[model samples]
Target: MSDTCSNVQGYVDPNWPRPDDDGSSCIIIYGYVPSFALGVLGVVLFTTALVAHSYLLSRYRTWYFSTVIVGTVMEIIGYIFRILASKKNPYSVAYFVGQYFCIVVAPVFYSAAIYTLITPMTKRIGREYAPLSPKVILWTFIICDIIATTIQMTGAGLIGRAYSDGKDPTTPNNILLAGLAFQVFSFAVFIFCLLFFLVRSRNTTDRHFKIFSTAVLVATLAVYLRTCIRLAETAEGLLEFLSTHEAIFGCLEFLPIVIAVYIFVYWHPGRWLGSESIHKKTGKSELEVSQLPR
Candidate 1:
């Protein structure tokens, strides 16, 4: 027993005792109690957002809300794993892997939801103001999101595998950095497109459109901020300051996403575009509305 324990002294395994236990020491400085508390808070908040999304879906029937719901669910699960890692065994590979993969990929779904909104919004406001057709814009950004998701997931898997195997993680870390960089670039482009649309359609007077557009802009900025943080965190590598620091993660990662989640909930697109669907109705009348112009 002593031999086995000594052999794995620098590594964490499922059979190892927690550091809080007598004669046991953690392989890494686990996340702090406050970090665990924050993870729990994230789970609760996301669950509430999920509930709100369901209610919105029932009334509005827009499939786009599903993306938000999925993203929230992933975030809740990711935080749950983060809480698990915060236990006396912070080096628990499974817990870290689960938390990292889920949390990082969760925002892609939010980006998708934002992209979905663009189609409906463009149609209602004026397609002429958009650089591309609604369908083209929707699919184009969704495809970019998919590409980013794939790269990040692949990189995460490689990093996790390398860590577990007690091998150097530099290659995988670089891959992860590349993936984060791509996501940051993609989000920047998406934000630019959104701003362009807003500027081009500034003449829109519909109250619902204004509210929906404002919500989208806020959500996009929040998500963009979070993405930039992630890019920096990844660039610093897994064991670096940003990666090890719970405070940075809580403030930059957890807070921004939660803000975006609430923004989407408060200004739910369904309220404007759902059953009794004002966006569709307004879109149909756009030709007539355009004749008057602003």
Candidate 2:
């Protein structure tokens, strides 16, 4: 605690660099002060997501959507911590780290929500359109998500320790980057699957497929935008321009995550994937694919 460079101390001083650091800059816990207004905006955005998701879950009973709610709650908690730190205790490491990683890993939960839709989507459109089985695709992304979350959480913990002990955070930062990198690669493969499915299914004329596909594409891309930015920011490390810049976090990270969770409000899975939906659309049953010749 005493080692904090200012309110929090820099491990590297620009004038007198650490043994390993380049002399160009220093590393500190927070590059700039946290903003109360931004934290409030985060809470408002996430709370709106929570309410919308909860309403959808209640009305449709798409229990899978609960993952989306869980992520929203975590985002709210993260913002609460941020709000507390913004004015009251900006230098408090507990609030700082808590706020940081909560937002960092919460995406994994909602990402799972999106990932699970692959099976239902394939069933609606036709399994043949995809190179891999929908279930296989679902499990693949889920497993990758679990691994990414684990790695990121472990790295977050090490980062806290690094700050407290005033030790080198290079290893922890690398661990975090590795996890984000893995997630990015997995998501890239998902984009391929989406595009492939769209191309193969383009000839089929199912209204539900169009809505479903568009929603999935929009939601997933929103998350991807946030994740890519996070990877860039973290790559810059603590106290660096990208890391400390609130504007980037608010505009890119928070906005995208909020958009991701809310997109489903209009495109709720139950509308297209529910048993009743099939009857509504075709007066039959759920139709992820074309009707068979009877």
RMSD of every prediction: 5.1, 6.3
If scored against the real structure, what TM-score would every candidate get? 0.85, 0.85
Model 2: lDDT of residue 117: 82
For residues 153-196, could you state the per-residue lDDT of candidate 2 as single tens digits? 99988887776666788899999999999988898888888788
Instruction: Give the backbone clash total of model 2.
Output: 8
TM-score of model number 2: 0.85
lDDT of 1: 0.76
Q: What lDDT does each candidate get?
A: 0.76, 0.77
